[model samples]
Target: MLKLESLVFDNGFARLPEAYYSRVCPTPVPDPYLVCYSPQAAVLIDLDPAEMARPELVETLAGNRLLPGMDALAALYAGHQFGHYVPQLGDGRAILLGEVKNAAGEGWEVQLKGAGRTPYSRGGDGRAVLRSSIREFLCSEAMHALGIPTTRALAIVGSDHPVYREDVETAALVTRLAPSFVRFGSFEVFYYRNQIEPIRQLADYVIARYYPELAARAEPYAELLREVARRTAELMAQWQAVGFSHGVMNTDNMSILGLTLDYGPFGFLDAFDPGFVCNHSDSGGRYAFDQQPDVAAWNVTKLAQALVPLLSVETASAAIGDYPQQFGRAYIERMAAKFGLPPGGETVPLLMDTLQLLAQNRVDYTIFLRRLCDFDSTPGALNAPLRDLFPDRPAFDAWAARYAAALRQQDSADATRREAMRALNPKYILRNHLAEAAIRRAADHRDYSEIHRLHALLSRPYDEQPECEAYAAEPPDWAKRIEVSCSS
Candidate 1:
């Protein structure tokens, strides 16, 4: 029940040296208005949902004005871009407004993406368009609903002011909330500069604030890298299980805290293609759907390299050496849960077979997995619904028989297993087609109803909401033409 005016503000990152960030104010926009607001995220910082109705709320979020507690600034960091080291790349469009502690005393940093120019703007306008802004806002909530760690979106503010990308688009700002906005690049920038003391200070700040348990360890810096590797591995497993493609896995985009930091050119599987490259700008397909795990491991290795000054080469390398094992175990365990089976090396073959079959036939990833929940293990129990998804029904039948036999080995009951599997495998994801539909409605006609509808639907993605059944359907043919770039 907190009001905007009543909320106390603090900037933890701002307490760092001046070189860590650039002081900046949000450049104002024209005729700012509220597009969508998330009450679930709002309550995280105890912001009253009622306060969203105030004109000042949109004004504050859109950089048209500021609340008494607000102190905006853009952070500084450098990162690897497409495996090449970029010496400087900070928050080009994102401005951290301030940080606030929720009722449970969990700190949440409030940031405005597309709030205009900063030192790291790199000669480009620090503006986010309506299309990309809406995608980030919805996917942030969608990922969170799926029990995945991600930065939360509080609200989106739109304006009549035009921003040019491939086409002319209206400007928008998404208010992002996170425990901390620090990334792997936050340390990489200093490490590459050979600034060892600043890197140590940054490491100390992170350990003291976020990973306090590691501070007591004999080798805290190495322990921190190990902990980050573990988290990144687990997160990659979740992303893979759910068929999500984070088209950009730059070190800067990888959260130091292991949350899904940046949402750009991201997609959920339509037809199962392991090499699905959602980012149109990524012609090289480096961050493909199936490549996420390896990419994450690479990013973590880059993080270890950044911390090389604090820890020995062998020490830093050893800390993250177990990343592959960690990722493998986590992914297999999740796949087992989706199949209502126990986690073991034995289950991996069945899991791999399921993926292979799905890919070979180009089956709709979400639908096939959800339908598998009802697969009857009993001999001669017709799995027509499951088999119907594949163009190659014979291939599916072979896979289904193996899966059924595997289920029998686990001694699972059909009804009990179906219920459990449904919980793990979502019926609805923030599909690119769905998001595009909502964005078109909002951008073209200024109709915000679809955005509200999508938000409500995605909030309970695991539920069988019969009224929203159309949303669970496969993508239409035209959806193939929908392209999302790095800018998105």
Candidate 2:
């Protein structure tokens, strides 16, 4: 058995007043067993990777056993869900098991999603299905491997216990790790209730913990708000450059620390459709791929409103106003990097022109980017691989001519340029079809080998895993039928 003393726990969020959250223990599931484990994430919490295979670890992760210093709780907050304010929404199915300081003394909160009900249950069963649990567990790691900011997953515990979603599904639990789970909604709750004291307390706590450098600023609170806005802008830019559709960008789901938080109905672009909406529940396409940058700005404006008590209206507005410029600069820099062009180069026009061409042809986004990495600047060399991706041969050739001209402006060797481009463009992404296939195998046959295989493949998404070439291909016709909603 792993000793409780082996872990170091610190309950920082619990230091706030009881109004911030409710103390609760997870409702244990029966017959807990390990479904998947992340060795990489284990090191972040100072846990030995080998310990993940221990039988007792499953019980501890399933919430049947509490390690020493574990002060479990469910946080409270409110959010605007789909543009409507739900005045009170909290962690209905997730429980914070407490914080563990790693070898570097950095603290990470270890929480279990699908660990039963809390005061914020809102009359629904506080259980997570195996399908969704597997999705979160794998996608978290995949996002991290792609060099994107995101919360990490430690392990998943599965059980025979039943959960009712679209159908009766087996229950499961995922252990999630992040510096803090606080969201924009955390402040909105107190702001809406006119609870000024707790609002100030939360701000001070967050600044002291996450934004310590801002503590000495003339307007610490205002600077904190600006920093959050800046980080959120950069995060959204990365999402857009990589063709990731968050599906839902609710204020509550927006991480204050700028990490990718919730993983519901999220999908990477298979075809380059800027207007794609991954979440079926988004009837109006409010959170469509193209609208994400604007929606993210709107969400930051809401957070600014909550901080009005501490920051002047002018100060808040100015900080929020900085989002568009921040997002634009970040997006341009990332896209430039993708093409191996220096920032502010004339190559930007070619990049934009290529996007329009991609949309016209409905090209596979990932495959196109990966193929471009092998682009030959040499004359008379075949550009067939990239040209074949588009149906309009002449249109693609015109764009290639401009791209080759841009490449000539660079003074680097072909091999060096290809290597740099390959590093930025991922060879693997957690596609919707890949996730659905894994979920089906686990749900129908109780087989979990696909889950493990994907975890391994996604851990090194940038590498060319020749053995897993099939995973890098476009989805088949049947995969287009799979629709993921908010329920996913």
Residue-wise lDDT of candidate 1 within 1-488, one digit each (tens)?
89988888888988899889999999999999999999999999999999987998889999888777767899999999899999999999999999989879899999999999999999989999999999999999999999999999999999989898888889999999999999999999999899999999999999999999999999999999999999999999999999999999999999999999989999999999999999999999999998999999999999999999999999999999999999999999998999898888578888887788888899899998899888899977779888888888778777778778888888889999999999999999998999999999998899999999999999999999999999999999999999999989
- Candidate 1 achieves a global lDDT of 0.93
lDDT (Cα, 0-100) at 432 in candidate 2 = 91
lDDT tens readout by residue for model 2, 1-488: 22445887879999999999999999989999998899899989878888887777889899898987999999999998988888999999999989988778789999999999999999978888898899899999999998899999999999999888888889999999999999999999999998888889999999999999999999999999999999999999899988899988999999989999989899999999989999989999999999999999999998999999887899999877889999999998999888878778686677788899999999999999999999887755669999999999989888887787778778657789889999999989999999988999998898999999999999998899899999999989998898889878
lDDT of 1 at 440: 91
Poorest lDDT segment (10 consecutive residues) of candidate 1: 63-72
**Which residue pairs in candidate 1 have backbone atoms (N, alpha carbon, C) closer than 3 angstroms, thus clashing?**
none
| Alpha-carbon runs more than 4 Å astray in model 1 | none
lDDT minimum window of 10 residues, candidate 2:
1-10
Q: How many residue pairs clash in each candidate?
A: 0, 0
Candidate 2 displacement at residue 277 in angstroms: 0.6
State, as a TM-score between 0 and 1, how close model 2 is to the true structure. Answer: 0.98
TM-score of each: 0.99, 0.98
